[model samples]
Target: LHISSSWVRDSRFWKLVDQPAPKLESFSFVMERECDVEDNLTVLPRIFQDDMPKLRNLALVNVSSWPHNRFANLTRFSLEHQPPHIRPTFPEFLAFLAASPKLQELVL
Candidate 1:
């Protein structure tokens, strides 16, 4: 299980990388705060699209700007570490969580 934050910061690269991570079981993204952030999904399409097969847990600790829209098969998650100034939309976050097919628990 591995959790990671921070997208590569390049939508082109994200799109390229997003298609071949099915082996990744556990994933997370404190989706690092970079100097700039445009479209979180357009850049990194979440961190659990194909990451399954071995994934059962997750830990996404990103800021509110990030569009949390995917995390499947996560039996456990630690989606916290929110900064005081961050205010992510629960609906988007929930939508992302809904992407998970095996998510059973979460810890924020």
Candidate 2:
């Protein structure tokens, strides 16, 4: 899911994420802006927790993972931040792989 807009005004996108998708195993989320509100990312853990049990790949660009716990099964990931390097460093993106304990590939 490419998250190109923020929920500052309203959470219209949340509706799309509410569907009960049982076959989804991988996800690619792209957010262009950074909004640090609590609820901003809080919706993630619930949105993906059910369908991502077998997920193996995940991608995030120009976004922020405040809690970062939503990705609990990713095995491959790619990220490109604004500066392109600091997003991973802000909180040890490599270490965050703990969420994806089976991860083997890390593409910056």
Give each model's whole-structure lDDT. 0.53, 0.55
lDDT of 1 by residue, 11-54 (tens): 65456445646677655555555424443422234543554556
User: Which candidate leads the pack in TM-score?
Assistant: 2
The digit string of per-residue lDDT tens for model 2 on 31-52 reads 6455444334322434643554
RMSD of 1: 5.2
**Candidate 1 lDDT for residue 38:** 41
Candidate 2 segments whose C-alpha is farther than 4 A from its true place:
1-10, 18-21, 32-46, 49-51, 70-72, 82-95
Instruction: Assess candidate 1 and give its lDDT.
Output: 0.53
CA shift of 8, model 1, Å: 5.3
